[model samples]
Target chain A: MIKQLFRSCIFLLVLNAALSSCSNNGVVKESSTADKMGRFPEKGDMIMLTDRPPQLETPLNIFQQDITPNDYFFVRWHLSQILTKIDIDTFRLYIGGAVDKPIAISMKDLKSKYPADSVIALAICSGNSRSTFSPRVPSGQWGNGAMGNAKWKGVKLKTILEAAGIKKGAIEVTFQGMDKGPLPDIPVFVKSLSIDHALDGEVLIAYEMNGQDIPMLNGYPLKLVVPGWYATYWVGSLNTIKVLTDTFKGFWMTKAYQVVNNAEANESPDSPAKVTVPVSHIKLNSIFILPEPHQPVAYGQPCHVEGLAFNDGTGIKKVEVSVDSGKNWMETTLNPEISKYSWRRWKYEWVPKTIGINHLMVRATDNNGFTQTSKQWNRGGYAKGFIEQLDVKVK
Target chain B: MLKKTQFIFIATLCCLFLVLHSCTQQKQPDIAKPADENPNTFTVKGSVREIFINHDEPDFPEAEGKEIFTSTCTMCHTLRYISIQPNFPHKTWEAEVNKMITKFHAPIDSVRAGKIVNYLVTIKGVKQ
Candidate 1:
């Protein structure tokens, strides 16, 4: 009996080591302890802003791929209590309020009942490059990694609402996710869309992202995909949809995510814009993918510069790159459009003449003939579509 | 003799499983709480797995109002939010504090809000 027990102890130790190593496999932690807050499960090494309600930013290099992988997608949540676990068997998306009939649809029903639809869209945060804003901003302090393009597949919100029989008086529809706040007074993260926009057939209740189930941090089970609009309206872990007759004056719509009601969404710090509206369609913007910040380019050699240009699916008319600040602009070759809502990749071939630091900039012009402004500022640091410049050293 | 041997084999299997499972469990931090609060089992029911984040608190410089800053601000988010921010003017930091209280409805009294702003400006402040 003693000999058998000793053998069991040895077996247990070996088993423990194997299981522990397996769990730690592929766990990549950033070298700088100060920059890396924590590594969440089901995600690669992300720039973790906050842990409680994770605000993770994807590394910039991950944008090289047109379709952002589910594992490397950026995550942003407002409330502290985010849903960590979900049961698809019991989960029900309740549609109620100004509808003729309230219906509770299960995950299985949602996938099987509705005609499945998919759209390649770019879901970007309104304050994506908030850290790069001049004079700086207090929130998130995110680099250009808070956006991702993915093929979202699921049912359309219009199909669900129509089946539920929308009442005539319904003017607006409110969406609420499973996330909640620590305090009852702290308003839940609720966003509203006009009844017309909700039924546009473009808005989707996404179940699969990039051909697979979305990572939990990126909103598993269900996520609202509002193409061409800022991601603030993309409610994650979505469970409730309510139609209302009156305009929804939720805090998220009115108090937060509001930008100046101007062409450029610009406002002076000294004289902040009095008139503000909820941020809607994304603005024209482009970002460099190659020769990362401070990454050197070969002098007297043809260097290939690549980047992504995206806007509110307005269709990119052209993308231009300037090697010497904004003195001269060369039109970049845009790759074939994947979809109207997806970001278009652009590339430029440049031969560096100077051997020292050179300023490289990129700007995008949309189908509406709107070019990105060189300098744009807003107090909220929202809707950052200003021209982006990267200083590359030539050796 | 056959029954005793069978019992020992089953007991050994149980022991090995328990030891392996315990080794794979994620280590929880003192400040951060996993969504599944059950200490006995970190596993959640259904297809989705429970997410665990190892939140190591950021170090803050010793200054006045550090206590009030850490206590009041950390109620909603971690200190990395502040750590990631570039130095802003006192006015900017003050506005941020007020925005948190007024806009987000963070339960911070005026006195506490002032101290928190002072602490942020003291460490992460700039003359702008």
Candidate 2:
């Protein structure tokens, strides 16, 4: 009888252990969905979300509010797989190049020395319109959600440069990120900027994005936030800082990231021009998020035509919505609380009076009087400002 | 003796109940077929044909392409971006590939570019 009791206890223990293992196995299987979607950073995986389209369906009108939640912010990384951990204390920012004093400032010092300032600026991809090009550009074929508005909290770039004492003859200020990955034989990923632009009070070495510490995918410890500049100028995992006495040349600065004018007279492999200098400010662009692609909407019903708009740094002067192609247009009311660097939300209440396919178009103009047009196109597919027109079947 | 037997009997019964409960709770390997499952798996005759007609060739030899794509293509986007696009003519495809080298700074070249474009056009391109 005693032996039987002992055997019974052992059996129960074994059963419990088996059940626990099975449950763990089930969890492992479920977690693979994100991995399969390529969201998980693995050995040999590039850290940039640019490595693939985001798993979430991109929301139209990315500028609905001032603060873009970390999860929703469109991610762009040049190199390094997703950073899982960042230690802020030990992290140091190196500021050098044509400076009276090249200095390395720790995270703690950066906060203590300068009065913290926040700015709202649009960070857009230079190749945001790669898909619309005659020959589809090969990159993340982002359908308009690649840009977002976030209120960045940090000390101004000029504040840091002034402390270091900007020297004369500094043609360009190059920034290198701590972000590292296997680049064939190369060991690092870096980008640079002109000294004039670096001294702009708006250029920031930001510690916080949208009122919080930036998430790992969005450059956690620190990142350069060049307001109104394309993301290529915004270097992540920034580690090396150099002041170039001559023109800065690297894979990113020179051979790659240039807008080669195949049609221009001087267009050649050796003489390609970098698209880094801010060209035309961000042209007016908007997207309809509520009625998603191919979703049905009822005819003769009140529908909210909602989206976001921005005029780069100039600020939006006006936004217009057209329900009948471009034949008719109406002014859209802007959301007042939107951040300056973030996108401005706009809405026009529309009742589709007719029952056919309604082509809806949206356009905007900045304070500088630069209006949105459908004719802009570049070889690299940069700055595609064509009006967003959505086709919906009205029942 | 009788008391001991009863105790043993109760303990055995409890153990049996636990064993049965655990077996029942074990997640059965999904018996239901997912809506998108394709049951028919077959080997393709050749790489080009498989890519062209079946639209099912790995972008590169599984080992080489995956590494190159991860290093180069992923600098800016995921593999699905390539997989999701409707295939285009070679000329249009070349222009698209060059845009990465030129605009977004993707680290691909004529040789790798040719391989990637061939694989995409064969497998992912919309049939003309």
Candidate 3:
């Protein structure tokens, strides 16, 4: 017991030091002794992005392992009040609106009626790295951890639409989750996608994640898995899927999560907020794996600089690493995975010959000739695709 | 003999630290406290059913507007939503405050909302 207490003492000291630095910058406050008692069962390194509606972020280091673990999957919800206890037996997904007829399909019937399929795909928040935006936009101040990849098992969304019997003039499909707000004035959290995007055969109304029933926190029972797209459209605890003839103008799609409609999708904060487009498709982005931001390296020792690169549907064609503060870059070897929708891991070995602070940069190019830009600017901080810089010191 | 004494002193210090840390952890949820000063009473530690809102020590810059800001805004969400953001201009804060009223239906009246906006602008807004 004494030895165990001694270990705990050392932990407290280290945590105190970490807390001092973090609390000041508001990186993460050291949860007081009181804070510790109330913390939910979360991965030690996972971060609480926000409390109400409960958004969580995965630590970037965990991404080094391909196929992020299911428990560590980031959680996000638009509504503060959620259905905690769901009776799967009685729970039926309602499909209606602009269809031949509205049908309430039971969970068992929905699965047994259609063949099940699995795909490893990434689900990223449109505002995944909103905190990094300058002139800081205020929403979920998340880092890169607001994204995850999972092998989702479910029936094709097209199959469900077919069962509902789509009529002519149905242009888009709107989705509503089992989350609600307290007041009637507060709009229902709903999002819609173009009918073509909805029926692409890849969209899965997922029941299981990583070969098991999805966790309640990460959208249990059912979730809309739109591979290669941002998670805003991938509604959690999804219960309602409605087809529409007109474009969706819900608060979620119209007034929020919008990027400037220009090609670059950037605008000054002072600029007129006009002509916006719904955030779609994951952009060509990359992140550092070994020697994370502010980490150190040894001079004259060989070390591999590794990271991951991903884009919406267009597969990653090239990923280049820069040693000289992004002055120039060289290509890295890509480790391809089974699914094209997943992020590809890249590696490049380098022997640090110079001493002092060194900057490492990474940029990726997707198959569609879309390469990352040096800077990405927007008010909403949606779909940021800027080249990443990792500063390290040679000791 | 001097080295032995030094080791004993270090051991005693560690033990004291352990006790202090355990006290802070306060494993059992205290059910009895109801005083306004007791933050624990506001947030019982043990229930998932409960929604507890806690703030960091020295959460924000102290000013006259903080009291109003805390009581009104935090009813729906945590103050960290505002504190965590990088400082923007009053133009941004004005739109944000208006958005709270118009979009989220924040209960603060126009006058109180204006005061809240002024507070945000003065404290966390762009430095003049």
Query: Highest lDDT, which number?
Result: 1
Best-to-worst order by lDDT is 1, 3, 2
Q: Encode model 3's per-residue lDDT on A1-395: one tens digit a residue.
A: 45755676687688755644444342233334223222323223356655565667887888888888876888787666765666677788999998897999888897898889889998898888788777677777888888888899998999899888998999999999888875566778898989998888989999999888777767767899899889888888789999999988888888777788765567776674678888887777898878776678899999789988888878988999999998888999999665889989999998898899888899998888878888778877888788887788998
Better candidate number, 1 or 2, judged by TM-score: 1
Q: What's the lDDT for residue A189 in model 2?
A: 59
TM-score of 1: 0.85
Which regions in candidate 1 have their CA more than 4 angstroms from the true location?
A1-34, B1-48
Which 10 residues in a row give candidate 1 chain A its minimum summed lDDT?
Answer: A26-35
Question: TM-score for each prediction?
Answer: 0.85, 0.70, 0.83
What are the Cα lDDT values of the candidates? 0.86, 0.62, 0.77
- Cα lDDT tens digits, model 2, A218-315, are 66667789877677777765656777778876777674555534221112233445443333245456666656668778888888778777655668
Model 2 chain A, TM-score vs. native: 0.79
Cα lDDT, model 2, residue A345: 73
Clashes (backbone N, CA, C under 3 Å), per candidate, total 0, 21, 0
Provide fnat values for all models in the order shown.
0.51, 0.10, 0.15
- What is the full ranking by DockQ, best candidate first? 1, 3, 2
- How does model 1 score on DockQ? 0.26
Name every residue pair that clashes in candidate 1: none
